[model samples]
Target: MEDKEFDKLTPEEKKARFQKAVDDYNSGFVEVDYTFRSVASIRVEEAMEDAGRVSEEFKPAQIKVIYEAAKADLNLEHYMNPKFSASHMKFIMEQEMAGKDVTWLPIGKILHRSIVDKPLTRDQIRRIKERMQRAEPKDSVIADLHEKKKEAARVPKKQGQQKKKGER
Candidate 1:
């Protein structure tokens, strides 16, 4: 409210803390989402729980499997930043999802893109199912490297080392 309007409040109204707060809120002066109570609200809670459900949606064990895939692909490595929550990372997984865009949406708006209040569409389900299925078997890249070394050892080395200049 403008200073003039605030000043016009009766001395008793100004002195009454809770009522003043309510009046500001009804006047659209207060931001409700930042309040502690918002954490338990449906949208906030969904955004919180969404961090896990997306990965667990397709396969129970695929979280680790997808991490392994990210370890192998340099292109996706940047988005694996420890600073971002898991749900934020999922939004950037594919080139189309968010690319470099960051969302300012409140949880209610974000839930539309996520599988919370509303169920995922058929195509969304199919695509996520296929993507998870395509990841390499969990923890296999290091094993593949080990196998490469084993295969190299199985081949014979040269019979003699290269001769140095007239030493013998």
Candidate 2:
């Protein structure tokens, strides 16, 4: 199917197709292996714990400064390195001191909210709102799928049990 044609399907139909594909793949009709590399799991856990201490009053400007410094500290290229720098380390410590919710959220989301909350020219606001409206359908579909998945996960399945006809 062409991409545009696929995009025209009702949300439920798209989900049903996705679920069937996953079920088939899981049953070994398709062979797939995925590998991912990331920072050590223990370190990631420790960082998350440290980030949790940042206060709600934390400033984005301060966070940006720390982020820049962190990029410098690990001798990472501006775009490729991940370790925190001395400045970032200090910011994290300050956040911890302030007793704030410093749990890290994806930077793009943080930036998006910051931008939308600020005063904007009428034209800018209109453009942003239009873009957001265009994006809403996809977001709604994703949310619906998440709810469905959660419902499915919560349902208990009996051992050695066969799914009833039409269950899938």
Candidate 3:
């Protein structure tokens, strides 16, 4: 669908259309047999749970197995393509530029790991953090003034009213 035409539908209608398309695709699916063994016989959810367990134990070998299984089952290659991943990084930079707090290190590490050949490194994480920090905005003078005004209002007033001792 063209962007203009797609904009005409309400969000709910758009979601319904997307779901229908997925249902139709699944119904028309076919299985192919190959000599190659499946990456792992586990379901995606189960693999993720296993990954979490391995992560808790800090075992890289166990984590690698789970990651491989997830990559095959979830088709992470397409979603984690460098071009797609860069766009997500760009979005995080934009958010930081707009004075929003966002962590880029974790996202960068995940993206680095998703690549089949390349592995994540500490240097990449430091670079991502540096870039995000550069994108952060400096404090505005007007915001400082507003904060001062609010702080002054919160102070208790001195007890020096028209009420003298023994005077009603």
Candidate 4:
């Protein structure tokens, strides 16, 4: 609200407005998915029963199997991100059911792309890190290199001579 408009409210009216805003914000937190809650409860119970110890360490073969299964289950991978809450998924699904175009912001698009994209191998990731380190402070070094390339591509014009018409 504009400062002048806010100034017109009495103290009790201001307090009521603030309380309503707080209630509206807090209401979003109460919509929980029972299925997700149950799954979490089961995992917590299992962890407690196991005394926080892994019974059998995952071998390479077992890890591959689990990874493939997760990839096949789209919902599992989408919800794996820490920032994706149950409510967000529900809202998106509701929009889809209503025949609306479900759009994502750039950050969400990048996150979703990363989740489903083929992952780089360990060696590839290592090489990329090395390259990034070699190109540290990207603005200065990269800009200089690009500038040099552009200079090389330019043709020197003759001194004291105007270009002919249509000579570019």
Q: Which regions of candidate 4 are displaced past 4 Å? A: 29-168
RMSD (Cα, Å) for all candidates, in order, is: 16.6, 27.5, 17.5, 18.6
CA displacement after TM-score superposition, residue 116 of candidate 1 (Å): 18
If ranked by lDDT, best first, what sequence of candidates would result? 3, 1, 2, 4
The TM-score measured for candidate 4 stands at 0.21
Per residue, candidate 1 scores C-alpha lDDT tens digits across 9-109 of: 88887778558677765543544555433212333224325453343343423344335334334233323233444443444444224332232212232
**For model 1, where is the 10-residue window of minimal lDDT?**
100-109
For model 2, residues 10-50, the per-residue Cα lDDT tens digits are 99999997897677555434322433222232233344346
- Of the two candidates 1 and 3, the one with more favorable TM-score, higher being better, is 3
Instruction: State TM-scores per candidate.
Output: 0.18, 0.18, 0.22, 0.21
> Which segments of model 1 are wrong by more than 4 Å?
17-39, 42-168
Residue-level lDDT for 59 in candidate 3? 44
lDDT of 4 by residue, 2-68 (tens): 6899899999999997886667444422213422223333332344344443324434443333333
**Model 3 / residue 133 / CA error / Å:** 1.9
- Against the true structure, candidate 3 has what lDDT? 0.45
Report the poorest 10 consecutive residues by lDDT, candidate 4. Answer: 105-114
Q: What is the Cα root-mean-square deviation between model 2 and the actual structure?
A: 27.5
Q: Give the C-alpha miss distance for residue 10 in model 4, angstroms.
A: 0.1
lDDT of 4 at 39: 33
| Each prediction's whole-model lDDT (CA) | 0.44, 0.44, 0.45, 0.42
